[model samples]
Each structure stands twice: as structure tokens, then as C-alpha cells.
Target: MPLPKESHYTLADVLSWEEPDRVELIDGAPVMMAPPSRAHQEILTELTRQLANYLEGKQCRVYPAPFAVRLFERPGDRPEDVRTLVEPDISVVCDRDKLDEVGCKGAPDLIIEILSPSSLRHDRLTKYNLYQRAGVREYWIVDPSARSIQSFVLESGHYTAKDLGTPGDVLKVHVLDGCFIDLSKVFPEAGV
Candidate 1:
């Protein structure tokens, strides 16, 4: 079971935390993160590599996990009021202004979350609604155990499920034009 949230945390509090554990602030609460498995790391590495290669010389850039993202529900919310902070497995940002020395100030163009046993619910439900509410253009949920990738595109302030690909399929990123990832390489050793 997940640990009880420390509900008083904000982005500043999360940043000032002395504990070494990986964590994220969700709706003014602190949620501890589990260490990723080997398969999770491998998948993240490959996806980062592919995204970086595809975005070369482009205005947009991709960032791997441990990068902070502050999501606000309203446009003019103060820093203290902006509570949600996430470290997505992969994030692509096209708006250069959103990038700062600390982290991303707003939603990224694309956010990808790799599902682990510990994060399945939060990623699929909590973060799904959070990203959609914050106006994220695209979201990808990559399930290593299930060997599947699900893509969602934001339309009319809501997410529309666009593609669900298995190991043998290739998935195109709607946010990143002219870029597609081969699912075979995404889940190797699996006969799909």
C-alpha cells in the first residue's frame, strides 16, 4: 500500500526536503516514489535516446526523470499556491520560456510516464487527470510488464485516447511531428 501523504508540502517544501528519497508533490501532498527496476531504467534510456535523436536541432528538447515540473491549476497562481510537482519518465518541452534553471514552470508539450507496480494508480488516474487539467498536449503511458504503449492527445481540454500499440507496432507521437518509435525495439525479447 502507498504511504500516507504529508499534505502540507508545496513546491518549495519539496525542494527544501532533506530526505534523500525520491518524491513528488501532488495537490499539496508529498508522495514517496519507489526506485525504478532494471527494465524500467532500460526502457527510459532507450526512449530518451530515441527522443533526443529525433529532436536534434529542433526547438523542443527532451528531459528524463528527476527533472522537476510544476503544474498549476490557474494561470496566475503564486509559487506557493502551485502545489503539484512531478518528475515524469520523459518530458518534451517546446516552449523555451517554460525552461528555467530550476525546472519547467508549466506543462510540457508531451509527458511520458512508465508504469511500475508502485505508480500504476497514480499515473493512470491521478496524474492523468492532473495533466489533462493542466493542459498537457500529449501523454504516453508505457507499461513494460504489459508490453504496451498507450497514447493520449489533449483535445477540447480533455484527453482523447489516440493509439494503443503492442510490441510489434509502431507508434507516432502527435506532438512531435515526423517522429515515430518502433515498438519492437521498445519491448525487446517479447514475441508480439
Candidate 2:
């Protein structure tokens, strides 16, 4: 396994460095993401738009990537100390402190990652653990190719996942009271 470089660099240092592509830190290790394809961008935009409509004037804020969300080991720690930085396809954060000029730097109340063939493994396994450990109340893994959404709720320090079928299936998100999203409306292809 490749380990993190011993040379400690601040978040500013990392951002200022001429990056060929977008990258995130996972336990101090760098993880690069493929530039989103058109399908991916369209799906993500729809999801963000739906959530924003539902959450408008509400406490929660829905955001789309390339917005960075830093999940640091310690609150108020320096940027260099930040080990996990991700730009989920979509995310909803109700915590004001997590919001900053750059982006959020902690777990959002809810996180949604739209999976592609390139990101399937990392999203299912690696990020599954990371988000759970970060204490995100709810996590949604939307697989456009599969036409399905996997809902995971953090329970007792672990995640409990449920398979939400196509359009008819209303995904009940525990974190958002009365907030249920019909997959068909969210994904145009999933519509009957």
C-alpha cells in the first residue's frame, strides 16, 4: 500500500501547487478523481437541484462538487492535518461551522456520491468506511448505470444499508424528516 509522504504540507500548499487534476486527501494520501463525464454531471446536477428545491429556506444546504468537504481528525486543526477531503456528487450540510469560504471541512448531515465504473469500488468500500467514521447521519450511493440507489444510515457507529429500487421506490431519508425522494423523478431514465 502506498503511504502518505512524510513532507507535511498545508491545505494552501496543496491547493497552490499546480495540480494537473483535482485531488483529495484520504488519511494523508492523495486520491485523484476522473473528470466527470457528461452523464455524470447531468445526474449530479439533477440530484442537487431536487435537494435544493426540497431544502430551500430550510436549515440544510445542498451542494455539488467540485466543492471540497474536509473531514479532519480533529476540529479546528490546521489544513495540513486534514486527512480526508472529498467532493461528493452531492451533499447536504446543516452544520454552519462546517461551511467556509473554500468549502465544507467536516461531515455533512447527508452525503450522496453518484457512482461510475471508475469510482464504483472506492465509493462502495473506501468511502463507505470513511463517511461512517466521520459520523455522517445518512449516505446515499446512486448508481446511474444500475438504476438503483443504496441508502446507508449510520446506526450505533456503523452503517445499515438498504436497496431502493427504481422510480416507484420512495427513498426515506431519516435525517430529513418527511424528505423522501422518488428515484424516478430524480433519475429520468428510471421513470416508467
TM-score on alpha carbons, each prediction = 0.91, 0.88
TM-score, prediction 2? 0.88
> Each candidate: what lDDT?
0.87, 0.78
Could you tell me the lDDT of residue 16 within candidate 2?
61
RMSD of 1: 3.0
What lDDT is reached at residue 177 by model 1? Answer: 85
Candidate 2 collision pairs: 167-184
Q: Per-residue lDDT for 90 in model 2?
A: 84
Q: Put down candidate 2 lDDT per residue, 1-192, tens digits, no spaces.
A: 232355443465556666435777776667778888777887787778778888989989998988888866466687766666777888899988788887888788899998988889989999988999989889999888777788999999999986575655777778988887767676675323
**Model 1 Cα displacement at 51 (Å)?**
0.6
Name the weakest run of 10 consecutive residues (lDDT summed) in model 2.
Answer: 1-10
